[model samples]
Target chain A: MTAPAGQRGRGRPRDPRTDQAILAAALELFTEHGHAGTSIEQIARRAGVGKLTVYRRWGSKDELIAAAVESARGEIPSPGIGDLDGMSYAQISQVIAEALPGSARTLAEPGYRAMLAQVFGSSVTHPGLMAAFWNDHILPRRRTAHLALSRAVDEGVLPPETDIEALIDMTVGAVVYRLLRPEPPDADELLAYLRSVYEQAGMIPRR
Target chain B: MTAPAGQRGRGRPRDPRTDQAILAAALELFTEHGHAGTSIEQIARRAGVGKLTVYRRWGSKDELIAAAVESARGEIPSPGIGDLDGMSYAQISQVIAEALPGSARTLAEPGYRAMLAQVFGSSVTHPGLMAAFWNDHILPRRRTAHLALSRAVDEGVLPPETDIEALIDMTVGAVVYRLLRPEPPDADELLAYLRSVYEQAGMIPRR
Candidate 1:
């Protein structure tokens, strides 16, 4: 409750301290008990903030979830168009190897799984979460992959008639399948395998 | 409570019907509110049985959850070698076509998603579930696909050195990726794409 002089206001101010604490608490509980098992009261208690404070800040459980997700998880940014334009297969696999672990760990969490289940668990009722992930992350990546495939064509690497969407689907889709495998291949192995498969498909220059 | 005629020998033991009722009620509640959201009192009232009955049958919420999943949402049976053998690509696709929809729909349910989130949400902790699915269902299918591919190779349909596992991963994986997609592709289109991809890999006999 120290009133930092620079940010002091006339009314009772919102606390950044409480917000960080809440996000941390939510991550812990979501990791431990799963998103479905966690409750607002539990998060508030873990954060050392009042229940009213949490509710006042985030409103509903879903909103709180969204806020926590915004803080705790971020997607891989779309590769810059220039980066995509000149990217070699080695460069592409490198980006994948770099980002795959955190993506693996986060997706490996029960909290994230529960969120996926909610988005996908009931296609009739809870499709929004899964849909947003595609629009936000999955689809954009495919688009980038497609443009890269076109560049590969221009570079005389792959056959011009190769289905870019299918090619991209096979590459990214394999990454996902590996992630969900019982003994998921390590990030390095996954990247190597991806490189191998894409190379076989003639997306990479033959050494 | 209907007293069993044979139970009179033991001073009329507690009604098995009551026990059944309580189990059913608990299952219903768990499916509605998830593992953590449900309460003993609510289960008892729904079952028209005593709270003590639930406590006696299963000591803790986790135990009750185990019972419900075991009894009601039990394991799915694998498609046998017979189905996978000597089938056209369409028939192969049809097997997945019929089976995946139900699994996909069930995955979409909130409470079910919650359960999965609890189990598979943190996939690192319980690799067992994912393993079970592969061992029980996917591995057998892979073997069948191998048989088909072997036949294709024998018939000079496919390249001799082709890695069958990677191909299987790509073919089957595409369907799985689509199922998990935010905007799940139409089933008919999905099957067509799956067949086309398999044909491209020379898994099926080409004219």
Candidate 2:
């Protein structure tokens, strides 16, 4: 096997800065115009990179779309699983309020919402891409949250028999639904609702 | 002003059966192919009627889409507000299971799911159509459920302070989230989850 092109001292060296530009461009175009509306040429032009550069880096439009989505996912902050062990209820709520609403704000953007709609809409026709998205992006994040929740249960912060997976699903799912609606709930309103839900669940005592 | 064609009836009379055929065809095509993919011509052809018939009845594709979605909405059974008073926990649980899972099953269909995604995805670009959909379809259904839930609160089946709107939003949103996923939860599983959530919320007591 040949050394990867970036490692070889042949031709021009691959610039990390150019990769960031391309990824950002890809994400913007994909979100704004959707999969069918976006083109690799448009992404290249937006990034001020050669068409060959994008192709060489991503292989195909599908791969580029996946990369852009993955990049977006990375930008969102998630709670540290390690922090769950010693965290108090207020601290956990703070983590959720910060992490979830920030992501909701991102999701509420017209372009980003369009991108998600495109992916979900096309999943029936493109099962492989959907599977990759689930395995690589959705599942890992879910597992992280799940593990943290399980720890909360073990520590008696949540009841022993609480269905952590369903709890996570319901909480996240409600936020997503609000984001997808024509009129999303205000961030403060959503935070308050979540606080009430957690309090009612006995995850935290009512204030 | 000239009398409408249906009433003028110079040559042929308007048949009610033909109206049903057009409505059914519109719903099918709109669900399967989405708003942009479907056309009046295609709908007419599918219904074995002339294109003029569709235009005469619905005026435009947007109106036709609204009519089709409205028709589908009418077909889904909702709990009457009258039924909520004095309903027992087990009775309420049964009502929720039947009403929710049935709607979920319909929403889970690839065709129906595509229709919803198309409407939601295009909301940014086509606010008029989206507004009409929300006004004519979403709002009415929500109102029905809201009235029923308000009765539940009044009857002491649910807490006096229950946030009926938020409760409705979270419950429906969770189901919508599950239905929209590539691998939706099983029907029975979702029903059980809903039951548990209701029980935990004190809308119903544990079995």
Best by lDDT: 2
Q: What is the alpha-carbon RMSD of candidate 2 to the true structure?
A: 5.6
Least well predicted 10-residue stretch by lDDT in candidate 1 chain A: A1-10
Candidate 1 lDDT over residue span B52-148, tens digit each? 6666666655555556555445443335678677775556545644554454454444454444433333344345544544554457667766766
Which pairs clash in model 1?
A: A109-B121, A110-B121, A110-B122, A121-B107, A121-B108, A121-B109, A122-B108, A122-B109
**Candidate 2 docking class:** acceptable
Tens digits of per-residue lDDT, candidate 2, B1-207, equal: 132234333345668898789988988886666566678889999999987777677667787777777666664566764676566545655665567667656665566666665565555544455676677656755665565566567667666766666665655555555655666556566567666655544444456
Candidates in order, TM-scores: namely: 0.61, 0.75
Which sections of candidate 2 miss by over 4 Å?
A: A1-13, A41-52, A88-90, A98-105, A127-161, A185-207, B1-14, B86-90, B127-162, B185-207
Q: Residue A102 in model 2: shift from native, Å?
A: 3.8
Give me candidate 2's interface root-mean-square deviation.
3.1
Give the least accurate 10-residue stretch of model 1 chain B, judged by summed lDDT: B1-10
- Tell me the lDDT of model 1 at A200: 46
Candidate 1 lDDT for residue A25: 86
**Global local distance difference test of model 1:** 0.57
Interface RMSD of each: 4.5, 3.1
